[model samples]
Target: MIRRRTLLGAAALAALATGAFAQDDKTKVGFIYVGPVGDGGWSYEHNQGRLAVEEHFGDKVETVYQESVPEGADAERVMTQMALSGADLIFTTSFGYMDPTMNVAAKFPDVKFEHATGYKTAENVSNYSARFYEGRAVQGLIAGRMTKSNKIGYIASFPIPEVIRGINAAYLAAKKVNPDVEFNVVWAFTWFDPAKEADAAKALIEQGADVVLQHTDSTAPQAAAAEAGNVITFGQASDMGEYAPMPRVSSIIDNWAPYYIDRVQAVMDGTWESKSTWDGIAPGMVEIGEISDAVPADVKAEALALKDAIASGETHPFTGPINKQDGSAWLVEGETADDGTLAGMDFYVEGLSGDIPN
Candidate 1:
């Protein structure tokens, strides 16, 4: 009877040890997206990164995501639930989730948090973003050369620094190539609203804008531009290749998979830390999608040259003799914008009409 009891006790201990080892071997990664995974833009690219994490880690890692999570109270609640469910690391893939991410990080000090396109960080939270402005400079070169009309339009999302930087960089490049070019800006306020994005594109087309650029996360503007017949547009975030060769002459592709894999690896190895990372073309974080044949051969060559210059550090997108919207000198000749100024960019550069909206 004593021998039987000893055998059962040893088996129970082994089972508990195996269970603990299993838990220790696996890491749970979570994601919070501001739009649907099918948006085919920002959220879609982020989701692709999430899938990359799963692919790279396989049985060692599990990923969970909540899509179309609106910023604000809902975001906080969703993040809380993710942390409560044993997520080892969570990525909040939106600028508006900055505050909520901090709040959740404070409550769950053990869980690591990464917020995209945001500056705020805590002991447990890290911020990351791509220098999308580099890609925008290439788009602007294409837009300026391709526009039959001197008028170009921009469909802006929120007035965040990231969006504003894209606008300024594109405008600067366009202005460099076409001195007579003018920008008509329209603020959509929402990041992923298809109807609103389409309406803004239509409005720009009606106003003689032959070239349209958007910071919003939808292909609706491309559709609108396609319907407008003579208009040209560029893809945002992901390549909306369906409209290629015409509406989407070229694109700004956000490549987040490599970075996502690296961060997940760090978490798995217990080496993750709260750090800020802003990568651009040089690191392959921001890719300029193929410029279609619809663009003149010479123009395409020039755009590619500009991309190379930016990547090689031979050119700075925000280099001056640039001015603020009020026509005040912002960067003197031979001067370049610092990371501090660019990260908190709130004003439009000179030649871009209207206010940035509060």
Candidate 2:
């Protein structure tokens, strides 16, 4: 007869071989969102990912999510609840969740955690974010081509690297399109604060901004643009074309459904591994929405062809001779930033007048 210790050893070895350790018999995943699911913006996109998980895993996976969670102690509470709920995988979708996620990671060594827009990793922790700035370059190009005022307004949430990169890319592309074009930025500080975002949009429109772009995730800006008359807007996270026919000129869509499904399936198949993913337009992570009737045909052709080039690895948006916001060189002329540099970007590009808050 096999000794009890011997039997236990055999079981442990088998579990290790399958990539699913003990206590992983039933995989449970938890998602934490920074905004309400009804916000129809950042939180909404994440919730969509959660639904994708359900669709892919069915009954084998137990999934739970808490929305509108603040980035402070509240995040700790939500993570604790997920652990109590017996989660084996948790995805915290917010940059502010970085520290809190790392804190909770130490407490639950067995649980696998994924944090979006954050740069932290442990044996059990990984980071994943889409190259949203790539899409922003496209958005800026469209906005520049469509703007009649030679003035563009950008509605921004925070000064994080992600947001800063977007603003700079948009500004650069728009400048390329119309050298006389100048951009004005309004910082709302809150990711989904519709009222403030709307107000910002109004201010920009009143200031001779004929086109409005947003890094904030809310239709409030679009609504504001619609009411203001003679303004164009873009969608975030989802396509707000229902608001089309008018102000919403185009959109930058987030396609996280397929990736979410594949991750869950990885766990189910006992092949889940920790790694970072920073896919962009090329990998279909950042999708551009339909161009409005307002956009001219030639502009559409140019943008679509550019999209294909980026997706097929023929070009890069952040090509060289780049400068920091301080006018100092960040990359030499004709030098391109590789994946590693872009992934760890902690500086602003040239021509940005604002500061990246600490």
Candidate 3:
């Protein structure tokens, strides 16, 4: 009887140990951010998505992130550390991190990687981005109508296709509504430099641009617009409602939570695969914030109608009759731009002056 009881206790102990190990099998997700999570713009929104993942998974998953990480060698090192530390999946949230992600992914085949705003993929890496140009169209409509000086200022980050597409979309929309509108674009060459962004805004304001738009990730422009007074601005990535009713007339919000959650779930379920995703307003990836009371009621309604049209597929922002910066016809009347053309957009549309910096 003593021998039998001892054997039963040992069996029960083995079962409990197995059960504990199974329960502790948590999925680990990691994120690499280009800017501080408190930037109140792009990185902030991405961090919010990270938080959403935590809320969704509870104890079933563990998430880690390294913010303010620069894009080159530093990014590779950070990713290597994460992979070595047992991260099942990682997200590198910047266009500049594309090559770094690919490099790290090649070394760690079992680790999944997701890169934002880029066009590269591997067996272990996927690319995803929002169609931000769609939202820029709406901002352009408002900027064109609201500008008292008829000179709209554009604070550009890098001259990549994504930023160029935004410039072209905004210019097309503005020129469509206000034929006399002109764009004064300043490429800051940096993504989240508040000082540079502020200087750019002030310079544009000095040059008589009463309306400002930004492709960079910071609220400094809005603040600059506020200090200058009588200038209208729009929020980027996140809804900077703090400056609303005057400088911040409207915004383009990036909703990343749903995508992050879906991808994490895929990794957890062992169904993860490499693919590209480019979502826009139609799928709720891009959102237009409130058109403030500062804008005329008629104009607000018009912008809302345009947003709805874009979301419903009733209108394409890049419809032709558009010309290149050199005055060469690029799009025929009533013709819409193809994804191939848009993805590799490198020239400025006619009516906008200045060359894209290499």
Q: Cα lDDT for residue 266, model 2?
A: 76
Model 3 stretches with alpha carbons more than 4 Å out = 1-24
| TM-scores of the candidates in the order shown | 0.93, 0.89, 0.93
For candidate 3, which ten residues in a row score worst on lDDT?
A: 15-24
Q: Candidate 2: lDDT over CA atoms? A: 0.80
Per-candidate clashes come to 0, 0, 0
Report the Cα lDDT for residue 190, model 3.
91
- Residue-by-residue lDDT tens digits, candidate 1, 98-162: 99999999999999999999999898899999999999999999999998888999999999999
User: Residues 265-314, candidate 3, lDDT per residue (tens digit)?
Assistant: 99988999999998999999999999999999999999999999999999
Where is model 2 more than 4 Å wrong at Cα?
1-26, 344-347, 354-358
Name the lDDT of candidate 1. 0.90
* Model 2 agreement with the true structure over 89-187: per-residue lDDT tens digits: 899999999999999989998878889988778878888889888888888888888899988998878778788778877887777777888788888
Please identify model 1 stretches exceeding 4 Å from their true place. 1-24
State in Å the error of residue 167, model 2: 0.8
RMSD values, in order shown: 9.8, 9.5, 10.8
- Give the whole-model CA lDDT for all candidates, comma-separated: 0.90, 0.80, 0.91
